[model samples]
Target: MVGLQSTEHAGDNCTPLSDERGSYTTAENGFKEKDATDTHEYDVYGDEDTAEIKYRTMVWWKAAALMLAETVSLGILSIPSAFSSLGMVAGCILVIGLGALATATGYVIGSFKLRYPHVHNMADAGEILAGPIGREVLGAAQVIFIVFLCGSHVLTGLIAFDTITEGASCSVVWAVVTAVVCFICTIPRTLNGISYMSVVSFISILAAIFITMITVGVNGHTGTVTASAHLTFAKGFLAVTDIIFAYAGHVAFFTFIAEMKKPEDFPKTLYTLQICDTTLYLIVGIVVYAFVGDTAVAPALGNTGQLVRKIAYGIALPTIIIAGVVNGHVCAKLVFVRIFRRNGMKSKHMNSHTFTGWATWIAICLAIWALAFVIAEVIPFFNDLLGVISAVFASWFTYGISGIFWLHLTPRSERWTTTKQKAKTIFWSLVVMMGALIMVAGLYASIVSIIDGYKSGGFPGPFSCVSRAL
Candidate 1:
């Protein structure tokens, strides 16, 4: 395989590569190269000559498919509800604007990774910007972000089971069953292993939502479909946050790029994710909201007739579970890498598929899934959980951090030297501010909504056996 080479243009804009630890550099390609004696440590495929497992093997399309599966997961379920709150004009604008912003930020992430080829996750990128403390802070944040996503999936699974079964079983029992199934599905150790499953995930969600759109369109709507709504501040912002969550997949881009066969092909992968998701979000959100109008519920699957609702949720089962599996793999890999790297045995054990490697990976997956189950039982409400996760984590990881990355990549001296460069500088500056505004305002809205839900008995208490089925 040809190594990833930075285009002359990409190289010109980037600062000369240097490493504090002197263990890696960008001279070999777009990736880092270890010393001669430690050559295998940073080999793109992790000592492929002897190792039983290889990670950097996915082609661009496969990586794009995995990202589509990971990103376009449960988030899509919330878009139509957002439309109901924000109305058609504001909802469509936010969806398109945010999707475009997510694409730009995602591109920034790809550039940052190419410049510092060793950076595999947010934590690594953090290290370059702020040192060990940055590493710890961003690393913890990334894990928390992915974990919340896992929890969201678990919550969706619970809802799916309840919706499908008509509440025949205790909700808690369904939550446990959901977690166990996610645990088993996440046992695959490599992105390459899981990429095939993502195809099924993508197809499953497409079929489920299309069925819903067709059914709802034919049956007609519950209330007026407006271009605008006169909602309160908290209500409106909460709706906007749901749209933000729909494009929150930027958090996983670095990890995806790391595992790609040709990291330089990431532009194709990024565009693939953005286009598919944006088009899908617009169609699904508009169609569902137009049909259900003001009475639309989240996860949107429940808005259909009883039989169709069950069928939609049933068809959506693979995406609900497999998408979670994709994220579960990320968190598990983060922990797995941190452990082995700390002990100076990463390449040997992680790449060789040793007993220690397999044991540690499985244990980590089990532990993370168990935590996800707890979070699902505690939160129990789908929209509120997504709102909080979007506010707290997605705000920074997806938007704010990427802006910082772009600013960091350009040489300060050159930032104002050209018209195009100046425009980029100004745009990225706004992106940073937008992320902060979303975080602060979004947190307030999400909190208020949750409080209101509890006060009005709209939300069941944590771990209550109440069914969240619509």
Candidate 2:
């Protein structure tokens, strides 16, 4: 210990963690630890009030269900279309490959949360990664990504409305209806209340997909099947971005982990998301594309014949609405806690008779959902828009940030001290590079696709009322 200058672990705020007592000075970085029995000190919230019990009350299974709903809803619906675009073989490969990588990154996020328990959102982690600037950058990126995700759900609900009612109303009206309903659902003040609907949301999507697979399989008519071994880079990349979207739940992993009754069960949550999404995605994509072929559409429900599509949409209604609610809840919670509970983990005013607190929460719900509505309507194309959003957000939040968190936490000396350590370092370094590649390459593909949409007269003017199907 001669030159080490040993010190206990310190958080970003240099907030003294209770339970572990005596501390004369703070550790400059978060990478070290101190004994639990040292001395007596208290954080701003104190030992008894670290996190309100209400915030961390969720069981692991419920947490998994919530994550599954948030991630698996609209994403799986697009996979058959990705398969159609990239060729069957390549699409399946991407599903498994990207899914595995996303799961790995998700695990990294959980580990980072365990390392720094004070991190309730990407913004907190961002502060740790750099300083004040990192918090602002990463925090904005996180909320924006979640807003886009919520918007995607609202867009899907509009599409579903069209599918079921055969365009009974203008697209804008349908979007408004979806946003209002989702905002209402988002009024719940806690993740525990939201998790109840998430269970239904997950079941709804699963059932809807099962019906679609069966409908396509039983029809026994290959609807213009075309298989290709080759694809242009743009076509292939678009397909890959859809896969990225399917596994792009990293924007939400921190909140889910933070709310868990046992943080150690996070791997179980990751396993739940990947196992279910990957298996369902491959089966649904390959089976549906094998039957529906090149004409297969994003949000696979469209690939079914008219009546069957209507039925599937009806069943999927819950997921379309509830998944967006879950995303909106997380986004709003990030802002809500920051404003009301800035000094502590949970606000005593959250569910109390506090009128201002309730009013603020309601306003946040309306504002976020309304913004999501605008995003959903402004970018009308489903798969193309998702590719754009995924490329812009997921590549960094889900992949790159997780890699950064891992590299930040692991001790520098441990990596170079042994051969195994060196190999591990190389592996994580490549992981970081892979995230950068996805961010750069995927962004290029998305921009190209959006331009193509404009050139081909496929672009609807922002806030235009024209049917998206046109």
Candidate 3:
């Protein structure tokens, strides 16, 4: 497989490649634009032997599918509870406003990549900003966030199964089933392969949500709701965190952008996710809350009538399993690629099928999924867990990290030569502060909520066979 090569051409604007980091040189200006072909950072991401075949092969649409599957998780259904906590007024504001912010920050990450094309993951990006310590910290955080996401998927799949079956079997049984299926689905060697399953995953979610909207409209039963309301600080922040979870795909953005056929097309795919997810979140949150009011469950399908819920959960089956599959694949792929790339055991030059490479990859996938399954069985409050996830991971991955990236790539910190530069600096500083607020406050609220759950016995024990739907 031939990797792309964009060498410098003879032009007056040429900037010679030197010891500099994060230079934005374009092909038209005769500066050598970094490609995955020969960079050490690229090799650290994946060895050159198998790089062309495994990475940098996805089109924008397939990339969107993988991203959509990752970003738009069970969190979409949690938005209505947010509406109930803060009413529709603040709820919509948080959803749309934070969503726009998430989008803008996402663009910052893309810009960082376009400028420094060698970054393959958050660790690499972090190293650019704060050296080796940053790499270790961000790399661990990336794995944690992805692993937690996989666990959330496992938990949600259990809920879907339990809702459909009405607790006919042990809850642990359903969870294990979900884990096994997710593990099997994650065995595909590439995101391009996973992208195929992502199409079905998207359709599954769409069908389930529509079923919910239609059935709720036809056979309506509702409690009182309001467009204006107030919430305690902890409660409001929790709701905001849920909205943040809806756009928590940034952690994987570098990975996704690295694989795209043309990384510039990333925003198109990002917009695809933003439009579809935010719109669905708004519609489903409003419609479900209008029908179920204060008692609306996070995955709103459970808020429907008995038969309607079973049908909706049945339709949602693909998404329940496939979304988790997508996340598990990402988590496993990151670990597998990082290890194999370092060892130079790619299939191109080595027999990856023997005990050395393929077996190790499969083992890594299984280990991550198994850990996710354990997470599903523990703690057990869906909304609370999501709040913790958003606060701890998304705050940095989606918001603060990009702000740092922007500042690093911009003019020197102390002196801005122009008004626009100063303004940009001010704007990013706010972005960073806002992220800090979410991260700190979000953690506090989530922990308090969890404590409250334990006090009220609202939480379940780990590996409980009892149904979690109640």
Candidate 4:
């Protein structure tokens, strides 16, 4: 907290750095405040000696754990299905290739955060690029993206329960139960606290997937394995977007860096995350696809025997709920910070436990969970939802926006000054174009898939009592 500053602004609008937004400098020990902004104190809990709540307590590993938990959860649930559609060769290629790109984009986000220490979230980053409009637009998009993500977790929870229970109870009831639990878990105000829970989340997912892989391998089901397949545009693209969604954790990278004890260590956190997720995705996608082939389903746990599937889903429960809790916490914190920023009490409420602050935080969490529940019930299809999210939001948050950030950070003259600079400029430009293409094509694929789902009665209608268990 010594060198850290609050990401909160003095007013509702995203303030410019010279006025309210200041910068950071690296010290021998770690990040030391160079020109601290009086507009907002970086420390949420004032007076470290007696403060009640603290936000900037995460070390690099803890942040890495949070990113791993957030990124690896439900996203991995669909990769085998992607492999089934795109084949083993293409699946492995996309997993590794997209992961490297995600790592690069995540690095850009860290550099952007270091450049503007006050920029805590996408909204703040947006302000740096385009003032109030960017802040509003990007901020809203971030919230929506996280909420939908949170809802996806809720949806996964419902699937787990139905799979475990063998559809003995209503899926709606399971959704309600999932939402309540996630809302309760999101009550704590600090990422540092959630970081510990993320450890359990990561372990839970590892165990579940390993169990799934072992069980499927033991069964030795024979199905066709193809290097590639012919498919329609919508089908092929949807599979691609599902893989894209697996790397969509970049949306929360800003918040992760903001909470880190040493913001400069973010590259370590980024690499840690990319390494863990990509390796897991490759192993899980390939092994599962090799065994189950065309018969594989999303949330690959469903590929095993009913008994083992139940066990895997039960084990996966923690990740399904906790990962969503992390997303809900980020979304709620955004609103909580905005509320305090508006009243000029951002520090007081954030620093210590106040009745008003606590109430607002709970209310925000409640609202977010409720909305997430509705979204879960409405969308109802797993692969389609992931496709839509990756296409619309992840395309920018994970890829496009970072390209913009790199372009904005580098001076035009400097971009062509050296061979390395020229190569980077060209690479980043291609990254931006790739993001745009994904967004446009992904939306189309998702829309078409959704319509096809309804037409084929592939899943029950929104809010239907039918079980969606894998």
The lDDT leader among the candidates is 4
| Candidate 3 residue-wise lDDT, 242-349, digit = tens | 788888888888888877878899889888888888888888888877876776666667667889888988988898788888778777777865664321123331
TM-score order of candidates, best first?
A: 4, 1, 2, 3
Which candidate achieves the best TM-score against the true structure? 4
Model 3 CA lDDT for position 381: 79
Measured on C-alpha atoms, candidate 1 has an lDDT of 0.82
> How would you encode candidate 4's per-residue C-alpha lDDT over 1-470 as one tens digit per residue?
12223334665433312234444554322223456554343332223445577777899999999999999998898999999999989999999999999999998898877766666789877876887788899999999899888888888898899999988899999999999999999999999999999999999999999999998899896688999989999899889998899999999998888788888999999999999999999999999999999999887788898899999999999999899999999898888876665312244666568887799899999999999999888865755776777798999999999999988877676777778778888999999999999999999998898888888888667888898776
Q: lDDT tens string, model 1, 1-470?
A: 01122212222222212222323443311223434332212322333545578788899999998999998888788888889999999989999999998998998898888666667788877877887788889999999888888988888898899989989888888889989999998998889999999999999999999999999999987767999999999999999888888888888888888788898999999999999999999998899999899888888887899999999999999999999999999899888777655311234566766787799899999999999989878764655766776898899998999888877776677677768778888988999999899999998998898888878887676787878687
Model 3, position 13, has a per-residue lDDT of: 26
What lDDT would each prediction earn against the true structure? 0.82, 0.77, 0.75, 0.84
TM-score of 1: 0.90
Model 2 lDDT per residue over 308-399, tens place: 88899999999999999989999998887666434333344543446777899899989999898988877656557667667877888877
Of 2 and 3, the candidate ranking higher by lDDT: 2
Q: What is the TM-score of each candidate against the true structure?
A: 0.90, 0.88, 0.88, 0.91
Please state the error at residue 369 of candidate 3 in Å. 0.6
* Candidate 2 backbone clash number: 3
